[model samples]
Target: MACSVATHNTKSNPPVTTTGSDSDSGINGNTNNTNRLNELKFDVFESITNFAGNFDLDPDQNFYKNCTNLSNYFLCDQFACKFKTVDTQKSFSSIHFNARSLVKNLDAIMEFIETLHFQFDIIGISETWCNENSPPLNIPNYTLLSKNRNGRVGGGVALYVSNLRSYTQRNDISLTNISCDSIFIEINQNHGKNIIVGVAYKPPDVNSNHFVDDFDKILTTIDKENKLNYIMGDFNLDLLRYTSINSTQDFLNILYSNFYLPLINRPTRITSNTATLIDNIITNSHDLPVTSGILYCDISDHLPIFQITSFINDSFQNDVPIQSYRLINPLNIENFKQDLATNGWDDAQMS
Candidate 1:
């Protein structure tokens, strides 16, 4: 569960629909757009200093070598990304956001990915505002699975999964009590692990008690399966303040009881007067190491949270140091002497 979050206000202007082109490869598109943005920024900053020398920056040299494998940047002529000869480990990368509406800001979302060069295997979107009749979002290499809010315009949840792996939407969990738009997807990892990723967007108007009860049921249902779980999205509850609100406290109590850990600690939403940590990524996989953090971007009113689910190789054994000396067994001395007596060393010395 590699995840990322972006901030967007719910009350912003109605987002314009930005359809994806046939050429839109999420990962590649981001790289190409980032290269272009860097080029433009370079042209401008170069003019500021009145430097006339052509800026022949090498992409391979400028980008971090360990950020990704070199094969990803093959578009840069012979300057492919240099990679270390190391074990190739698999990982699931994802981004989560309070999109407000997918159709309205799809372009900016793509642009955001480009600017940051974010690589994701899945994207969880909250507040999609897309319904059953809306046109299909045609991103090149991902399939969109969404749950729209009925009879409403502002709430919906979606998961855009990369086509590289097989996945299915899990419909067993009930959302009636939760009072939010939500989605669940079970990703079939190529490395033989199944990861269940759930995204939810709870409106502020919903009754907290009811929300908690419903959320508890959802967790109970998921916990029974015992699969690696990653739940994220805009809960609309400020986790930073447990004492200020009963709902916040109850919500956290349930999480702790189930061994679910909240990965984002910093504020995810901020305004002139307040900074609130409303978005989060929760997980219960103790054996598998998970790394997460907050991404400060203006794609939504809430900051994007990125989490990575990495595969730890179980094939290699760690080497232990050995002493330079050894002790001889006392009981084997007679056998050793007999074996030494049979040696041709004495005959060779005589010869």
Candidate 2:
């Protein structure tokens, strides 16, 4: 199955090189003075280059004192003083991994998270293998929302959202309702529309047609919400064989018809014998700038996939007061009258 790909164009500019020459006849007449001037120019250039390379320079150094004079030079542009402005855009990052059994690899997973350069807004885990008897698991500064399979041992899905973000779980379309291991949450934005994020896990043993039908229903429910949607998981259906497998083709058709594009094209799970593209992150937010890829890690058989979406901040005036009023209905009016009549007005008047 052919899919549309987005391309980006980057413009590159050549670096500027500077050279010093003694053009004055007076200076040229004196070779020693000309050589001295050339040496000085070389020293200055080297000093600037060294300063740019080293960030641990002393605050009281002569280089710091001369920064103002050097600001006129192109090489010193980075040292110029400027006011820092808050960015008007924010990014939402998410990562999904099939841990196989989260209980066994919790320590390794935490260590892996600590190694990340940036914090992820959402952490999705499939095949958690959690049951009612499973121990409570926690990650610092994150709220856990999980749906564990009851009366079973293997299938479960979990979502961990940063405490800083405001969100609400969507129980209406819970994965349990569709007989799948998944969880859905709506991320609340201060000004713009909210974003819906879901993580699902489809067992390989299940009937593909039933899975497709159930997944289609979930997509339909999400489409009706009309919000930016990101659905990720290990569906266990190799997308590389979309053309050959009817179920895989049907799955892609459902996603494409709903405007959700799968971002991961390369194989996510690889072994000595075979490689398959079963893990994926699909989203309907085509307009938003997104970067996605798989992270090479040894935590599990399947690699981790991540997506970073940049959303333009929609600023709103906080000073504007929201209008509010109380409703005056017959029931409220009667309740008010009954309360008034029930009060000891005669006793108060006599007092």
Candidate 3:
């Protein structure tokens, strides 16, 4: 409830004002800002994000010219949609972040979805209250990976991938296991590539990092036997602005010690700061040189950061994958659903 926000002390930036225009926009004041806006807008808004991400190995020389850069963020009126009205939209891909509510309007949701269909390679969703038993959704090139907390709402995350069968990893756990756990997964690159793509949401709590530590443990388990990793999610803690309780900087110390590096560079832009950065992309410190870093975005309610990490593959690491259950029979599914219908879940309850 009461959180201290952080501030941006960066001075290199020029003043920016989003010009109100009908079919087009004009910013005759600062061409430099316009160039930066143009550069950031194209790749950042193109829904089908396809950045190579951070691979610790020095890319095959001349990679800079070929390396992909994808940074897109969304805030749908309700659930997001792909739009067709914008005659000139990127075709590479599209991604939509929807916050559908029980009390929200329906048309606005459709419009947003129309806008979203414009482009997207992968899509991450939150606040979707649907469970495993619900009828399948009819979305093209889109396969859903959801963890529904309950039928009412709260604490859920999912990924919609195209050609999902080619990418492997399909989770068919029931509503009970899904509700009881947070949704976090590593979507590695094609052909056993080592990049681990992830998404997460933090509940409103001060002891959030401890929960993050649990998430980290899961990462540890996954990467325990496999190396090379990259993760992005709503971390909910801005180390620059937040400090934990119980006698000292245990959380920050642990986070940094684990080689966690937020996607932001030094003197990041202010996006409603409250002590620490609540939304972040974390990777090993080696991914960045501290001097050169990723671009920080302020388009959504949360600031999103994108890193152009150096190339260098990590040493092979082994991690024992966490024991995850698979749906066996009709009885197991019904029995698990019954258990969830009663106890449900609490945000405070972390594994």
lDDT of 3 by residue, 162-253 (tens): 55433444232112233223454444443323444455555544355456556556555544544444454454444333322421134444
- Which segments of model 1 are wrong by more than 4 Å? 1-89, 190-192, 313-351
For model 1, what is the alpha-carbon lDDT of residue 148?
Answer: 85
What C-alpha RMSD separates each model from the true structure? 20.6, 26.1, 18.5
For all predicted structures, in order, the TM-scores are: 0.64, 0.64, 0.46
lDDT-wise, the better of 1 and 3 is 1
Error of 3 at 322 (Å): 26
Instruction: Give one digit per residue, the lDDT tens place, for model 2 in 25-127.
Output: 2221123322222222112223333333322232223322312111011001111111012122477778888988888987888877776545688999999
lDDT at position 180, candidate 1: 77
In candidate 2, position 324 carries an lDDT of 27
Q: For candidate 1, what is the TM-score?
A: 0.64
| Better candidate number, 2 or 3, judged by TM-score | 2
Each prediction's total of clashing residue pairs, residues at least 3 apart in sequence or on different chains, is: 16, 0, 48
**Superposed Cα deviation of residue 255, candidate 2 (Å):** 0.5
